[model samples]
Target chain A: MATEHAHVEEHTHPGPRQYVIIGAILAVITLIEFGVFYLEMDAALMTWIILVLSSSKFLLVVGYFMHLKFDDVRFSGLFFAPFVIMVSIGVVLMALFFNLTR
Target chain B: MQYLSGIDDHRTSTGLDNRKMLMWAFLGSDVMFFGTLIGTHLIYRNRSLSGPQEEILSIPITTISTFVLLMSSLAMVLALAAIQRGNMGSFRFWTAIVCVFGSIFIGFQMFEFAEFAHLGLTPRTNLFGSTFLVMTGFHGTHVAVGILWLWTILFASYKGKIHQGNSLQVEIAGLYWHFVDIVWIVIFGVVYLIGAYGAEGRALEEVHHAARAAGIG
Candidate 1:
């Protein structure tokens, strides 16, 4: 158990400074998302841009702020497995809705 | 055999700490829960039969609220770091800040809800109102619960029950808090930014026509 735990701790967890930097990046992404709302562009292109920006922000919060990047791989698997399935289901449902609406 | 670190001292047979594992499991389930709610909101978008949908959603206000919640996540991580370092003062300070920011986020939500009600938009008004309120309202409930959880941890730290050797308690709470922040990031993007943009655009067009009618522009 001790050796197992030591192996886990070999991964470096971020300090407060790194956490603050991640937070700043998240804030900037959010600002850009809000600004993009007012920009005149192709609606589809705008949607894709917002989705990309928001996903990047999401990854940053999960990776750094949640410390998933530094934690045990098992932990990441536990979280991301369900998340990926959920997102896949969401996409399927939205596609169905689009089909019906069209 | 000795424990690897003080935080990992309570590890289970899987070599992972029990509380942290449980928190992750719970968060995984929560991801599915919010996923359904968000999908519902998106499906019902623009399906309102009556009542205001877009004009009532103020992007600026929500943007500010989103920033507040993001900072709270930062505060939460800082608190976890401080406790791990055994700095009681810094831990308590950052924990208190997290609670404060969490409460401010809730306060903003409450204000928005009340203003929406004032403008005659209620859950019973239309499909959009029902799904939107239910989804965002539940998310607000999660934030409120997180605020209370942080306050409890803050009080525990005050009693000296939470220390460097047992920082996992705060670490788990921080995990939950960050999850809530991430959910709001998605909501802000899907619901507020894109969901309301079309309605707001139409509203702007109406204003333009009114101005032209009055010979003001």
Candidate 2:
């Protein structure tokens, strides 16, 4: 009985309405991104804003659309571990190249 | 509704289906792959000694394609939901929408590439051209593969192979489709918006003024 309950929980997912709401959120974030892109401001500030907005969209898609939020934590552990490492390496590589190019 | 026997394969030691676990592992590796590509692009940004730079990029058109891809993701998830609910009609409808949206995105990319090449920004144009084209070209190829994959699953549905019992197939495809969408979200930000900022003539004007001040031109 406990195994059956676990199996049921594993497959539980949001319905169409919830998915649509999440989709709408993602769309609005993209529009905001477009608006932010056109604004005149400090380049660094603009870059940070774009990063935050894009990260939000990324998390939403991974969490909701991909069901990573409600699904198994092991899956998240498997994916995010490499994800964090690569992002760090990517940033470090950028820093290295920028310095060399400068 | 009849349940698929293999929906949740618990035979594994981790109590997870091997197929889904493998997909996640593949995606994890793909994150590193794209991270390297994106990092290379950023590293070489603005290093093009000559040839067309970011100034020639068409932001408005690319933004529309971004929006289309985002909507296709929504359609993809909806398709999966429809299948899980045993609604084949809705599933077919949304699945076809995803294919159409995917094709439209690819069409926009083709137009952009043609325009850029016409302006002399091929892979050999400069560092910017090489990195930019390679990174985005790989992404476009992934999107193309995803469209074909989804279409195959959709066709299989009609043959009675994709019922609620076997909706895991659709779920797996949805995962791949969403991964493609997320990759584009990152590309749109890092490559198009941030990379092209002020390159739409502002940066060129700045360069001209600098050259004039320095008495070079």
Candidate 3:
């Protein structure tokens, strides 16, 4: 629902350049994620790396490709709140699984 | 009501949009479901209940599938653009393309799951099985649902429910499709690539830890 500037914008969409940038960033994030497998770190850092990378890609795709940026900001909230809660539950479930396994 | 400002693209009736809003909320809750499921997968991944486990995720195979899904998103969005421009022909063309791409992705997943099951990894087996099957299985279900939605739209389009003026319908469907793709992006990194690359995950983790140790994180 983002309004254009009275018929003077370059493109209706965010322009192809933005998509390219998004793609490049995603590729970099993917590389970083895969890159983590080689290091000798404790469990906490390993988890943190993946979490940050995943969250970044998630935000970018939803905000850009989904046009949540152009659409209502409420849509972003709708998408985000669940995401955070789900991630919290994800953390709890993983921890619970660990405890149960032990 | 004031919140309607952004999404008000001149729909005669928001009946569908309201329904979509509700469905999105439900899907939001399902987010928690997948999160828990993936969490379980990660937890048991290190434990390795003694079998061909995450080792068989096949980064190359999943990478191909991921590419397919990503392209499907592009197609779906293009379909929306077509519809918005009031070109029914192009809309139908692109929506059909979107459906095909989505189906291929789902079929590949089925094949992968079958392969894993054949290799003795399953929810019935152990903890790894539980998390792996549940998380990916839910994702597969979502894909199936998206396909069903696409096919329905296709049928409706042929029957006249989806038209050039109704690009928003396609947009909503595209939104769901993209959400599914986004989820896979994470799953790709966490489950497939990390599970596959083997060394980068630790390396990146160590780098982060070093940063945090240096108070940079």
Ranking according to DockQ, highest score first:
1, 2, 3
Task: Write one digit per residue (lDDT tens) for candidate 1, span B95-211.
Answer: 999999989999999999999989998999888789989999999999999989988888887787777656778888899999999999999988888777777777677779879
Q: How far does residue A74 in candidate 1 sit from its true spot (Å)?
A: 1.3
Candidate 3's displacement at residue B107, Å, is 2.1
Q: Model 2, A1-102: lDDT tens per residue?
A: 434743574468777888889889988988898898899988899889989999999999899889999888998987899999999998888888778868
lDDT of 2 by residue, B17-128 (tens): 7777888898999888989888898888877778888888887898899989989999999998888677999999999999999999999999999999999999998998
What local lDDT score does residue B156 receive in model 1, on the 0 to 100 scale? Answer: 80
Q: Give the Å shift of residue B137 in candidate 3.
A: 1.7
| Cα RMSDs, all models | 3.9, 2.5, 8.8
TM-score, per-candidate, Cα-based: 0.90, 0.93, 0.75
Docking quality tier of model 3: acceptable
Per DockQ, the best of the predicted structures is 1
Any idea what lDDT model 3 has? Answer: 0.72
